[model samples]
Target: MAHIETPTDEEDITDPVEAKKVLRKVDWRIIPLLQFLYMLTFLDRVNIGNARLWNLERDLKMSGYDYNVVVLIFYVPYIILELPSNYFFNRIEPRKFMGVIVMGWGLTVTFSGFSTSFGGLLVGRIFIGIFEAGMFPGCMYLISGWYRRHELVTRMAFFFVANDIAGTISGLLGAGLGSLDGARGYSGWRWIFFIEGAVTCIAAVLAWFYVPPFPENSNFLTPAEKKWLLNRLKSDNKGMSHEKMTIRKVADSLKDWKVLTSGVLYLAVCTTAYAISVFQPTILRTFGWDDLKSNLLSAPPRLASGIVSVLIGIWSDRIQRRGVFCLGGFSLSMLGLFLIAFLKGSLRYMGIYFAAIGIYIVQPLCIAWCANQVTSSAKRGTITAFAGTLGQFGGIISALVFPSKDGPQYLPGIMTCVAFQIAGVIAAINLWVCLSYENRQREAGKRDHLRELSQEEQDQLGEKHPDFRYTV
Candidate 1:
């Protein structure tokens, strides 16, 4: 093992005021660009739901389960590519790599507008998935590198607020663009793809210029600020931040029980979220709302979800507890799903608000919770990507559950989401108990036997180091 030197106390930011200033500076520089990039990413991915309202299925001659297949195919490459993409993110300049991938997806989305057949659209979706695989997990990995563990959820909440905002924007844009039904001979659905995709390409150019490198190499930060930030992170992570990427580190992250459980937690939230993002318009239509009205109505639930997510993030970070918030959020989502499945009329529609808020809240909390447990940058990236890969299964499941045949109540799909939320609640409770127990054991010096190991071996222990405590 290669040992890295730890930052001295002299390099640490001891003054609370100065520390806050540095954090705020980092927040403004990185978070907004990440928010914009991710927002566009989400808008491009889920706008297809909106497009369905504008006759995409009819225009392309899609029938039966063809639309579902289009949704399902995107996740195949998406799930397969995430781990490798994160692996490459570690080895490449993040801005350059992210810029390239964003451009790739943007172009795919733009050209997808021109598709004349189901096969053409399917091919476009696959390419979009391939290009977009790295984005969310990559953002999570980058955010973890910049902020302390306790500060993480709030920042990630803001990041995911972009996701909710994108959901809102997708609905609004769909309504706005769908009205263009024919402009220069293109249908309103094509306009959605063309306009959004073009904007993404433009954003991609800006991303190449603005997205900051990791703290260690960030040019925007003064050397003193960099030193302080690095020292703070090193102390927070017990010097585990100094570890290099290695095969063993990767393998260790893959096998970690905590990482796997976190994935289950994430999966439950994502399953419901993905279902709503892709099918909310259709679901609303079943409630007797016209297509445009359905598109317009979808905005409020997502907007409400964004607000609740930010509030929960602030509260979770202040309390510095992850599991309790996750449990609350998951329970709220289950309640919403239950209402949506069982109720009728306006009551059923109101359930969407609860589901949206709950799912969005749990999504970021689970991501930050998972990232909080791992100390090594390499392992953090790998584990975040791994957990994220598992979560994408929700997208696949979402596609299958809400088939057109099941619409006008979609009881089976709604119930399926409810089941996953219950699973999420259980997973969250189990992880909390396990992590809290390990933390107590570490505090009691039960892991002190490892102190006799060589310096390199001790460093290699990463989160398992006796002095390291997990955030539950």
Candidate 2:
């Protein structure tokens, strides 16, 4: 495999104006396409929640616990395939690999509408899980490759905003399509699957043309701009090394304490996020709103959360701090969970907005934070995928927590989410303290003995190099 070589002759882009201009150009070309792809991915994944609102369970003859079983089935392959899919993603051309997976899931989603029984739906979800597994982590890895550490959280936040957009659109689309329940003799929920899936298929086709390759292979930038971008990223990690995917690197990533801790944080956040995406409409319906109103009302919280995410991304980047922001976000989420679990009427509804904002805020930040601490491409990709795989367990937990028997105010489910949020807070604090201690040790020259190693050995050390400081 080829590596991105930094040009020896090229100087850094010293002018702030030119730097901003180059970054803006890159952002416009890539961010929108990435956002669109992720939006579709999310839309297809969670629209099942909206589908339930339109008599999908009744029409398919699903009985007690059957609906949750279908939801749980999607996460099985999704979690299992994440590591290998991302491994191939690291090895393959970005455009080809991403396009194929998007198309695969899109077709699966479309055909999913044809299911006549719970077993059929279950099968379709498994395939969807397999295909969709690579997307979010792959995108995070790709974004990390493009931007420097300080610029990363904001870009990732913008990318993650796609989730909020998809959630909002899913709600609106569910209501609009639900109105077409009898059109062409197909149920409205079926139309949701058919139409959204078809759009994703089309987007997948466009991805082949529009998706930017990794920086080394990208043709859209000038030679100078590309060199500057690559060099900028190189400087961000000082002793960082580029390496091909290898089994050892994968094992190293799995063994890293930082990776394990980050995965635990992500798992906590994902548990809350998956629960909300899959059950928000149902929870809202329990608030005395009819199906249409439940779907419609779901949109606002997502929109509000999207705005908050972008703002926090900018602030987090400005301060160049991740852990503190994450702690604050977790606090907000816990507050929201408390209100929803214990309060009544509109106050409980207000909890949705709080939970949405905090969860969305923490999620992208956590990914960015993890990526920030890793300096090797291979290790970074593996770490991202491994953490994401652990996070998907949250989807399984979500499926089990909100049984149909626990409606109106699913106290048990809401409280479970609250517990996860508190766990996230503790994890964040532990990671922050540990990294801060490590950084202080490096400053005190405790790691100076490793500086005697050869340059090649030092480079291979990646984040463990004496000069390579951990981001707190």
Candidate 3:
């Protein structure tokens, strides 16, 4: 039902400068607003991790294993509804559809503030996951509609930085709000959910008017500008087709191995990334710090994650490489995972937390890198959503694996993260090798159908036009 306007058969033409000129004609007003909305989307999901050490555990009377269980409840519906939600996202206007989703999850998050028992917490989180799952992939699809192929990495990087900024803001906000314990009798953890969720609700209300539906719908651009934008897209790949069904859309999508590969690597990244986000506060407590201090100190490592994620994303776009950056990121994370697995004393444990910070920087790079490799707009949307939705399974597993009893070192969780990092590295390498082989075949005039380009695409990429190169 989602209709993204792509170029029609009659509009297929080839002039690079004219295409670029056409792109300039479209409006730009809504871009900043959409980016901010997603930053809040990502931030709200992870802030529960920040609340772990504050008052969440005590209020729930969580046993040795309850922490991970709480997070696992979130992934159940989150995984099931991703593709369907995205398909609808394309059909409905983002201004309305994404606005509804944001508000739905914001209310769920706010309701969590009132939960007195773990059962109530699980119910709130499940709905949060269900609604929030619509955000990122829909945005990726939206971005593809706005920017051309060559311009994607930089734009994706800019959009992704909001996710990192949310992490930083979570820390800063956690520090200020954690001070609210016993203020008007509300606990520190409850305050976190209440305030952040309220902000999300307000942002959701605003998004209804702020997010542009498509080029044609954008009042910021003249009618001439909308046609120009449509033509630019036609040049890329026969433009948009919204008549596709969700099942057929997915079936067509599976023909590309990039989806499977990206999903696996993202799964691994999620493993290591969630380990840090979900457990870092608990890890901090292993040091000599008490509850408040542990919560306060946890902020720095996440802040460090924010700083490093932007630096790496910018560096990646500049260098235009994927495998090496992705591998290096997993390597840093693996080192951090192992350090915690093997070491023990408080000071030594603090050092392990720093390694955790360094590891998280790799995730956004891998996502941006993988996103660049996928071409078709609809296919790209499915893959991005699939990758993220599947990756959260790591969150589900960790909820059961790391208990309060495993605290102080959480050796098993550390080992699992390290092992998954190795898996992530292999997935990245495989992606590089497969794409490299295809790149070579195109050079040799032997473009086969085994994940190689079809003849129509071969012609477009044959010249290796400055506009056409693999995302890596």
**Position 453, candidate 3: lDDT:** 55
For residues 273-346, what per-residue lDDT tens digits would candidate 2 score against the true structure?
Answer: 98889899999998888999999999999999999999999999999899999998998988898889889899
- RMSD in Å for all candidates: 4.7, 4.1, 6.1
Full ranking by lDDT: 1, 2, 3
Count steric clashes of candidate 3.
8
TM-score of each: 0.96, 0.96, 0.84
TM-score of 1: 0.96
> What's the count of clashing pairs in each model shown?
0, 0, 8
Off by over 4 Å in 2: 1-14
Candidate 3, residues 313-374, lDDT tens digits: the string is 66766776767777777777667667677776754565555555555566666666666665
lDDT of each: 0.89, 0.89, 0.70
Off by over 4 Å in 1: 1-13, 243-247
| Model 1 C-alpha lDDT per residue in residues 43-139, reported as the tens digit of each score | 9999999999998998999999999999999999999998888888888898999999999999999999999999999999999999999998899
- TM-score winner between 1 and 2, please give it: 2
Regarding lDDT, does 1 or 2 come out ahead?
1
